[model samples]
Target: MGTTHDEAAGPRRRSLLQAAVGGSAAAAAAGATTLTGQAAAAPAGTAAAPRSGGRFDGESPRFALAVLPDTQYLFDADSADPDPLRATFRYLVAERADTNIAFMTHLGDVTEHGTEDEIELAADTFGELDGKVPYSVLAGNHDVSGSDDQRGDSAYLRAFGPDRYARMPTFGGASPDGYNSFHTLRAAGRDWLVLALDWRVSDNGLRWAQRVLDDHPTLPAVLTTHDLAWAEDDGEARLSDNGRRLWDGLIRGNDQIFLALGGHYWPPGRTVLTNDAGNDVHVHLTNYQDRYYGGAAMIRLYAFDLARGAVDVETFAPWFLTRDPERRTPLEAENVELTGPADRFGLEIDFAARFAGFSPVPAPEPRPASDVLVRGTVAYWRFDRAGLPGAADEGAPVADGRVVRDLSGHGNDLTARRLHTSGDGALTWSAEHHVGQPAHASLRFDGGQGPDRGALLSTRRDAPLNATRFTGGYTIETFLKLPEPFVGEHAWMGVLSWEGRSGDAGKTTGWSTEEPTCSLNVSPERFLQFVVYPHVQDADPTSWSHALPVGRWTHVALVNDGRRTVMYVDGSRIARNPTQRSTGIATLGKPFVIGGTQFAERYGQGFYGWIGDTRIVDRPLTPRQFLTPYR
Candidate 1:
């Protein structure tokens, strides 16, 4: 972790998510390039771009790498000034401190037309950054002079040849035309190599990328191409033309290449897969070139903060200077409308920890759910094993690391997808605390941490768990114990929620309202609450009931039987709300979320304590059936 800015004032670590951090050190400490780069800048008649929100300390060992997706808009023939593109580089120079920005990568499409003027625009803008910080660029489909079939990026090479990057310590080698290359850098005491390839890599080019990885076997690698992963309707990512070939031919065997990044396919998507060697490979796709004026000058920031055991990702457009409307024109000049959750969020990934035996691969075998009381269990998670088969394994299972095992007949297992990608080892299984009734382990969720870092379980939305088409009453139950010190805090905490996105449950869906199937929450006043959307608003004064006992094992359950809804605590009715004569639960399009919902605000408000057996049945349980004693 980096030391605080003012150590003498009082030793305190800077806020991991807040606190703006850079501006080219004082004149005396400014490096030669920092001074020369800004001095040589052309007068931007327009207002300056806004400062990026991401910040870091001047002396922090943690670093960030900025990914500048498709800059084809900067090369637009209709543009009055190429200020957006220029602003991106300037933003880097301004926020250089907070970011500890080690490198910048352009995911190709640097030009709309392969003309000399456009090429120079990119070259000159990047040139200003040339001496200050090392950067690399990959060729996109639009980078060449001719159509796709006649593609050739000779101009791109001439502008960014070997000579241009020879001084960079990490520069490994590049193709003659500079369409393919690699760079090496260090973060969190680990070495990394970034390989850049053309829009469509040839067989020879693939071999070159492979050879680069072969030569630097000790270094982790990130491959940048023009087009790779694309989003699918099912929410899973599928590879494109070049992507498929690269994966099968080059990436499949290379254990060193952990991340494959690309642009060109719009609507960003990400997926992680385990290679033949059991190493987790993360593939990410980002492209804003088709949105407002070719992506509204947005850039992706990958902040690797090992101290927090997570990677904080942010998307900010330094060029979208909206504070001063006079300068905040959408397309003509600086963009003004691009800030949203889709563009910014922290993903829990602690690469440093993962590199140190924090394997992303699941254990080969995991324990199955133990036979116990309470029939009609449609989905369950014991958190006992660490393999895919999990609680569903028919054979005797072996305990691996921590895993959220789904004991339900349906394999609706939970996984920390975002956290895994960002490199955090998600949940760590604990045997210290649990309701030993079923003789199963539990999971401890540490609250008030970074985004989605709380104790939560995420399972993919599948048919068996798809509540969207259900027409029956339902029951949800969980055993949890809150820590003694956590009850009085005036912050909302989540118990369980169901939806597509992460945290809060209720969300708008199309023309019709899609209330969360249900949400089990703990209010700021320590009250156990149950909320059903559409029929019940979140702000309803009666959303909650009496206070729950603190620091004690408690079993909470919610049962809806076609009309009225009743809440139970430790097998006793605690609260009830009579509802209109309607179907008990609304079908949801998202997955079942345990411990937390997908609402962004309550992202870190996960239950802080031990969560024992959690089970959900499609039908409501009778009072007697619900309180059955455990063996």
Candidate 2:
């Protein structure tokens, strides 16, 4: 996945993540000022606690940790000011005993070049906090050499070696006398094993990490590396080579691995992936090396509220605090000089759900049609004929093997126009994917060159079900499993849509010139978006807050109550329209299409995944009803 942005720096930034990387008048002032003056400016002991502007409203964590992004900015040969980097470490030393900070973590790139001088400066700068706080320093591409291929030899270890860490009792171990290492910390009634992996860890490194994970199966693990997760030009999250390999070889299978942290990419990013055990592994990437003059002394303060199962991340510039007040953005400005959402945010991490001996519900039972009938369903499509387990019709076509049966009994059968065909001269039925309901079939769409373009259309040519009939209220719900790699992009990958025909060129939907009636689709970010015609009312397009987890079964429901429309994922309400529209759909008669959509023309770059039971409720479903499992 990639994130789209201008390659040219924004007005205040040299790169996307460099929004907070500018050198201000404060830097000059710090350079000219004496150490005694800097110390007095914020008085490290109480010196400007993490700006109380984060989501938690400044609520301090039970324990916190500071994440130091690349310090290459500190040693850049082109930069004259060294005060920012030193000030950063000095602030840490001052607050080490003040804040309940257990330790600090460095995401690598300790120096500009793997040169002896740079490494020495780094060691001396960081050494200030050597015994003051427990910390882990990872190796970045820059730390090794001028280029990734030209890895440096032993300069880093010579500067900060085992002897530097030997004083700490929690120091678990290191890689054959190298920077790759792990440390232990106790919090929330649990011991956390934090692993700092080098920039390009070798096969041995992976094995060593796995052994560490295996040895401490009872402890929650946090992984840190130089480069890992990042947002490409497309705005989708992607893993680097080392990152993917690490996940495949080490992180994925380990149930105790809870968080993966990284930097080195220009833009800060985040993505949550579930391991095979259905546990979420939070991956975060933050770096500001692209900022002007090697970026300001901004650092991330992660306050872990273990009891609340949340981590409130705050970005602060301790150096900027010592500058004249008028030179910087007021602390009240949400900008915090870091322009994007990734600079600060809160995440809910339910450790109990991941670590508390959880097990999958075996052979989940199916939800019966009676459940929908009682809820006044107007239309339903259960692709029962496809993928039927152990049945003669299993792996057969809709009419030949699977039956496109409607649960509502309104005679609206679906035609699997384009589906995955098997190489054995028969369509393959998946037996392992069925969830919540045993032996229930689900339609799979191949995001390839297939006839009908991987879409399922209503067999009924005169499908009377349109948004016009439900102006008062209605709901569309389905059980969906997103593709493993996520197949769609900037454009729409239709889950379901009803729109004006191409022949009706003059027809217009309030939101779009062609898309009318109603369409429910997933955005590139994977959030659900429900659209009603002419959804141009500034609030016409309402989307969910949570992105549907890929490769997992999830229930998505969209409800509109005449005025307000809301989206629900799983069984929780995620988002709702901020402004209610008084007018309903202007155009209606188009036939409903599944797996893809149609607006001006058939907008079917159809979704590639599985869709289980899809139902259209005649009335808006309550939150309780929306929470109903696909069973």
Candidate 3:
């Protein structure tokens, strides 16, 4: 219950609090309460009224949680003023839709003394959010009579006990002594638990917290308490004596407890600790009572973005923000937003992987080959059949002459071949594939460009795909992932190409006469290049894409109608597609190559990455018809 400030500067009382109390009284006399609307229509026992449109979209991948900490000075009995806290609640109510706020939490210290007048005043002010937003509050050292939860029946308990939240949707259950509680919020297509613990939890209280976690074993838990850590002026926080006991008793062994938040410390700080499961547990301290106007009821927002695997934090004072900018004091302007490292930051967490231990996300099953064989499909090849006679097993090197049958029921089979100076390990089968890919496996090529050595797969000389040209339209689609640290030698690698040079095909409108007629290649800058020599015109329509991300799977589609061609990366059209008219692919009736393009009818450096399911159609197909479904 004590802090370093108590030892260094006598007591915890600040002259700033006295000044803030007098100023708050003057602001209240000036009709500041009119800034916020009337109190909530319903009390704490009814269903919350929805906003203008509807309730917040909890199922969205992006949502926010609001945190209010240490508002004791504002609720001191004689000098109490509820305008600041009311403004914060009003802001949460108005911005609920835009922010997608799921729930709000109060880290205790709601009043300076455990008196009925102080607790009742705080309760009446909080009525502004009774049915508007779901919130939970716990007792702090100042809220109680400097005793643990074992000392029951206080004014704080009578005002904010489990009975006050029994009808709320998020309220789960409370301990028998009524000092601790837990709530479950449905967000991000799942449930998240928020545990509110008393200032000084007794042994029974600790057991109650454990029981709550045991009941909901799979849900991620966030523990909120009154005092856990303290920080110096440098904003580096360390565990207090009570914080260490709580960590050893509750947080260190619970893998589901990924975050712990507390108040009762100034100049908010944070630190990350490793749990018994070897996972990071973020412990943060947030309290602004020492700032201007008792921190003006500042709110800290935790914006959880599941798609980005990050929780972005921002702290600001809604009360100060409502003031006229021209009339605001220097302190008020400075306290509008906290830009310090500890106040605004992002926590990088792979949510799926981090929660896999308790609740595993099932991997999608492999789709049947027939599911993706569209109407105009000419050839479709997948490297998923590992145990077949001619196919290589997962992690095994592909044989020199492995024949991969075309799944389109056409005789466009491909044969694997090793380059002159490459080893048997040049090509291998892998189980890594994109999440939305139909196939569950891919081919990893260890190719480079020093002496032009690698591996490739090519259709036979007499294959029908080699002779036939798609005059109507064409669609080429593939899934690939480049290596993380793509080396310089792997630059200008080819993914797929039609064998034979454009000069041999009687076409000259290209960068180089020796280049393949139709090829999909990666440039030195990691941009995708789709260059095609058409039969109807002498122009080569080239489509260049933005730089592809390294170590990430990407779906590429090259669609050409009867007139023009368009290239799509991950279903989005690139910006650099040429406007040149292109109709039929110029073929030399020799062979169609994959994994590498030919220079002067000879294979050079092969593709140096993992390639998944690839398909080519005779007519142009929309993005929805591609192998991977586009959202």
Candidate 4:
């Protein structure tokens, strides 16, 4: 297929992606150019055509929305360090400010660090974004770590806003910040519950959500959980498995959960999955991955015309504040009607007008028995700081230019040694932490070896580059022991990297192939990207990945089952993929680093933390496997 390639295509891809997700360039490329004001709903008589760039927003349309991750870091110090909000502040402004977006919602982890100053700083930073954009935030595992059980988050409320089973008003008003971490917004006519689950916290969080849904049984909803519910790794630890009870209690049994999926860090950023009823629900995850890739994970801006049920998605990839790219709409609503009948007469709500008077005009236009629907997503990231501990001195611990070898380590024994942090940062424990315990320490991996006293983080397996295996699904499970009542930074777990050669670059692919399936990272410091799973089709012909869990001796695994890829936490399946095939092949010349990646963009040039019982099994494991209690 030696077709003449288009170089400009890359730039164009960037341009299209930027606007699709509502980025700086996205606003500019979009026809209107003004992201602040609402897109004037065109005359109903006109062809309800979507805007040119496929992006639209309303200032006070039926509703407003936003997405923010890890606000707790605002005041929380790195144990004995104070970089003066240099990194955090830049990150805050990058996503919410420098780049333009419709709404900005905080992803939680908003300072359960327990220091008064840290708490205040967290409040101040959130407040900084209040007036700029409509703000909404959810609670992370860290948000409720201390004794108050998130009661101490009052400062968070004081600065940002509140939500917990709230309703959408058809008029003007601000978002209330209190009670819990979930809410709804009715943009045009349909209702969308901005349901944000409390990650790494109490199982009761799910029960609280169930009560909220029980109170409003009929509302259609979009469930947003911080942890990757459908993660495609191994060892079982995803919320979907560990928290299935919660899902059963709140979402699965209900019809309101129109869509479910949202986890940061990894590849295949955009994805869509239908529920049992086959509704065209959507989900999104991005890299803003703080570990391996040094830039923002990126996101796609979404605009919905509920009145018309017409959605225009665009990509937004600006300078530093990166937004992901627009994916081909994989699934659509059966009727593809944005507006339907919504009659307020006699207590009846017609869904017609809600779809922009979408009455099917019979034109013998390939009419099928029923309707068709496709699903997909948009995602990316933005890396702000780098002057931490093991940003530079870290590198993959495997042999250079080596192919696949036994990661289980040593003389083909299938058993591997755990990669421990080299006193690199707080990630290294003076002693050992038990399972299910709060973690006050973390390994900050950036692209530098600054004024920190941490040791170099690296692995022990370094095989030859040419002899290593390549092509196929591989599983690496990580065991962690997180603090109880899990919340904030203490929440640990994630995979490091599988570089081809070079530190974080692919030796074979980087040097020859077009698609370099190399360099990967998974970090917990940025709760927004508490997880990571990446994928790419036919890039030269390979794709690489890595994932992790912040705190807890839990197993985090990845599996490429032909097309149906799966991720698991503690043995329970968390995510699934339908594109990449499982060839049982992989490039392993690059040793798998721990505590971080081979190169720390935000994760690590090398790891700076602790890893134990690291197992790399060739076959995929199920959730029940994790429950069996390691022999």
TM-score, one value per model: 0.48, 0.48, 0.83, 0.34
Which parts of model 2 are misplaced by more than 4 Å?
Answer: 1-61, 78-80, 146-153, 233-236, 328-339, 358-631
* TM-score result, candidate 2: 0.48
Over 423-462, each residue of candidate 3 has an lDDT whose tens digit, in order, gives 8778888888988899888888888888888888889888
Please give, for residues 1-631, the per-residue lDDT of candidate 4 as tens digits.
0000123123222121111232423333232433423222233222222222212234323232344333333334753222222222333343342233344444445554535566555555445434434445554554444422234445444443443212223212222224245555444434445566544434455556667676655565556655543322121223344235444555546656654544332222434444444343344432222311122112234444433344444322221211111221211111011111110001112233221222322222221111211011000000111111122223333222222223222322111223233232333222232232122122332222232222223334443322233234444444444343333332223334443433232324333332113332333542212212223232222232234444544555454443435555555554333344334334544444434433332332233344433344434444433312222
Model 1 over residues 1-631: C-alpha lDDT tens digits?
0011134235544332221222221211221122112222222344444344454343454678888888887775556257666777777867666567877888888888757777777787777676666788877767675432124447776786677788887688886545788998766556678998887787777777777877887777788888776753233467876689889988878777777888876556677877767767878877776566566567778777764566666665555431233333334222232333334445665464444332243322323354543566777766554323344322222232324556665777776432212223233445533333243556656554444345456666564575543246667777887777763342566777766331133435322233344567777777887766433332222245677666767777777664556777766676445453434444455666766744532254456666767777767786565533321
TM-score of 1: 0.48
Error of 3 at 535 (Å): 7.4
For residue 219, model 3's alpha carbon misses the true position, in angstroms, by 1.2
Top candidate on TM-score is: 3
Candidate 4 Cα misplacement greater than 4 A, ranges: 1-64, 70-103, 110-115, 146-179, 201-203, 230-243, 264-270, 276-280, 291-300, 307-310, 313-631
The digit string of per-residue lDDT tens for model 2 on 485-537 reads 76434245677877565224343334555564566776777777777653223
RMSD of each: 21.2, 13.8, 6.9, 26.5
lDDT of 1: 0.60
Runs of candidate 1 exceeding 4 Å displacement = 1-61, 77-80, 145-153, 232-236, 322-342, 350-353, 356-631
Q: List the residue pairs that clash in candidate 3.
A: none
Error (Å) of candidate 3 at residue 537 is 7.5
Each prediction's total of clashing residue pairs, residues at least 3 apart in sequence or on different chains, is: 13, 19, 0, 171
